[model samples]
Target chain A: MRDVAIIGAGMIPFGRRDEDTLMDMLAYASLKALDDAGLGDKSVDAVYVGNMGGGMLQRQTAIASSLVDRLNLMPAAAETVENGPASGGSAVKNGLLAVASGYYDYVLVVGGEKMREVTGWRATDFVATMTHPQAEYPYGITLPGMAGMFTRLYMEKYGVTREHLLAISLKNQEMGTLNPYAHVEMALDRGGIFDSPHAIVNNPTSADPLHLYDLCPVSDGAAALILCPLEMAKKLAKPPILIAGFGQATDTQTLQERDDPTDLKAVTLAAQKAFEMAKLKPGDIHVAELHDAFTILEIAESEHVGFFKKGEGGKAAAAGKTRLGGQMPINISGGLKARGHPVGATGVAQVVDIVFQLRHELPKNRQVQKAENGLTVNFGGFGNNVLAFVLRRVQS
Target chain B: MKKEIAITAYKCKKCGKLHYPYHDRCLACKSREFEQIKPQGNAKLLTYTAIFNLPWGFDQRFLILGVAEFENKIKAMGQIKADSVDQLKVGMKMKPSWEPIRVQYGEDVYGLKFEPME
Candidate 1:
């Protein structure tokens, strides 16, 4: 099989986009990617749309067809992929394979979710639909609840403290203030959020052991990427970031079923597979974006992905190892914590951020110095399903 | 009359790995055949959390939820019978009961509820 490389990457600012419909967001992001590729009215071989809640929230289905028509890209094959929160990553995976297999020369992969269209309660319920229908859903288990339970277990087993979690919250939010595309631009203060008496009102408990700041905000946004063969991408003016390796894995539907709830086996396996395929260990990665839907998740994923030893991820964050300019800068784009997780958009947005880093286009504050390789982990359903990708900057 | 737990656990005939919410095949050995068994005796609290921002269906301000393992090795999610999560602890003994955990369509929905066995 041929190698795949990202030629174009684009995304809109993430936040409460009440004005744009799901279809509109998809179309807009696709157009930006198309223009960025300098394709200038050229048609792609296929279009892959990653979305999770169009049917549930907008009462819309066959979104791929709608997006293709909206973008005036008729006659190209169109398909919509749904993999819970990993929909964006799954769509990119599909596009990568299509191009690598030589079946499609150019593929447009876009992921978007207009979650802000619904109230917070309805959106929470919509996300909870990913839980086990019989065992979890009927019991009203939301994603934060799952994270809260996981956080409790991690604390008990690893001795992770609230200080560790606070470190991630502060670091990511500070980075978010510098990321124009991030949903939350406000930097959090320790006194207002934790140290002061006003902390209770500023950071209330959404789930036990995890405060409001620990969770990503519900958002509406879209991101897109243009993928083609590595050979073709070499002709472009900018450095083409190669999709060197990718991995996806799944675990038991419910957390209780796993032998050890704290052991995110899927995360470990997925990252291992990606690293193996890339022929590079985690230590070789210069910058990374982990699935930090919850503060605790960033810590857990860091350990599972082998960036740090188990039980040390939390401490690593506290010591600033994961911050930009540190040993390994994580979530320079602010991650899901500050960038906002629009489910379907997140996976594509992550790759887009990595592409920006590889291209050396970002301002120094958000860009890693002399970055060469980047990795992304898109988690779904509380660690049950996860996708990992390793991207490398190929000198043009 | 004591109400039954109203839950069926499947034990892999080949691997003896017990599963709740019945899997089509055993996760361990992938055995197709299994024996149905009822959860026996009290349970041990494994992990729990009190969720404040509930979904649309839940009306209460907060709900205490947890996963507990029964004596028969059947693990499941249940509503913890406590005012606050402060009373819950991991590895603590809990008394399991089959009762109404929620209301649906103005009708009582029976499910698992765990009370601290202190």
Candidate 2:
């Protein structure tokens, strides 16, 4: 099989984005990537659009085909991938395989979601559709509701405190201030969000044990990457980032059905598989972007992905071990906590950020010094469907 | 309203693993044959949450959700009923019962709910 390499990465600022349609957001990111690749008039061979709610939120289907036409990349093979919040990661996985198998020369992968166009309640409902219809949805369970329950279990079993959660919230949001495209760029203050009596009013509880800041905001944005065979990337303007290895795994549709829901077994399995394929251990990773849909997730996923031992992830975060320049440097892109989760866009956006880090293109403050290898974990559907990727920079 | 919490579970004929919500095949053994069984008696709550953000059809100002482990390796998610949020705790014994949880599509929906075991 041919090796797959990323040549260009692009993303739009994630926020309310009231004016842009989902297609428009997708096209803008795609064009940026194409321009970055210096492709000029060289159109892509295939386009894979990762989207979760275009049909439900935008009332538009056949999005991949629509995006291809919109981008004037007609006749390029087009398909849409949907795997809950991991849709973007799944799309990139498919793109990687397509290029690796020699079936496609140039592949364009983009993920975008326009959730702010609808009411927050509607968007919540749209995401919950991934849950078991009879077992979960009928009970009025939402993603935040699920994460809150997960956090409670983690706390009970692992001794993770609200203080640990607050650390992730404060760190990610503060880091968000450095990223031009982060949704919530303002740094959070402990007094306003936690310490003071007005904290309750300022950061009302969305789910018990999880205040508003613990949860990622509903956002609208898009991110894209251009993929080609490693040999082809050598001719590109930017240094190529090889898709070293990837893994995807699924758990039971319902979280309760798992042997140990708090274990996040899928995460462990996926990361293990990716590491094995990459011939690299978790300790070898220089920086990481974990799916921090909820603050607890950043902690839990860090452990599940083997950055820390079980029950030590929260402690690691509390000690500032997950921050930039720290030992592990997790979520240096502000993560879903402050970067804003546009569901479909999160997975691809994660890879794009890692690509930037590996290329040493991020600003000094945001960049991991001499970053060589990066990891990404895009979680979906309460840990039911998850995708992980190991990327390494191709040194000249 | 009389709420009857009758949960249908399936024990894989090959692996003997039980699925609470029920699946067509056994995830462990890939066995398609299964026998339907009812999860009985009380279970221990694994964890819970009080969700202040209600869904589209849920009218409750805040809803308590819990996951409980039942007999024969069965696990389920249901509403947790209590007088005060303080009453709910992980590892506490809970009894599953059917309760009116929401009104959706202009119809009352009933589902499994958990309460402190009597």
Best candidate according to DockQ: 1
The superposed Cα distance between candidate 2 and the true structure at residue A140, in angstroms, equals 0.8
Q: Could you give candidate 2's per-residue lDDT for residues A1-396 as a string of tens digits?
A: 998999989999999999999999999999988988888788999999999999999999999999999888989999999989999999999999999999999999999999999887788888889989888888888999999888887898899999999999999999999999899998999999999999989999888889999999899999999999999899877899999989989888887777787889889888998998899999999999999999999999999999999999999999999999899999988999889999999999999999999999999989999999999999999998899999999987
Error of 1 at B45 (Å): 0.3
Taking all chains together, the TM-score of candidate 2 against the true structure is 0.97
lDDT for every model?
Answer: 0.93, 0.91
Pick by TM-score: which candidate is best?
Answer: 1
Write the residue-wise lDDT of candidate 1 on B1-118 in tens digits: 6689998899999999999988898999988999999999999999999999898889899999999999878999998999998888899999999888777798988889899997
- Tens-digit lDDT string for candidate 1 (A1-396): 899999999999999998899988998899989988988899999999999999999999999999889888899999999999999999999998899899999999999999999899999999999998878887888999999999999999999999999999999999999998999998999899999999999999999999999999999999999999999889998899999989999999899999899999999999999998889899999999999999999999999999999999999999999999999899999999999999999999999999999889999989999899999999999898899999999976
Candidate 1, residue B17: lDDT: 90
lDDT of 2 by residue, B7-118 (tens): 7889899989888777888978989999998777778888888888876776668888888877555778888888656897788888878877788788877888889874
Off by over 4 Å in 2: B1-3, B71-73
lDDT, residue A38, candidate 1: 83
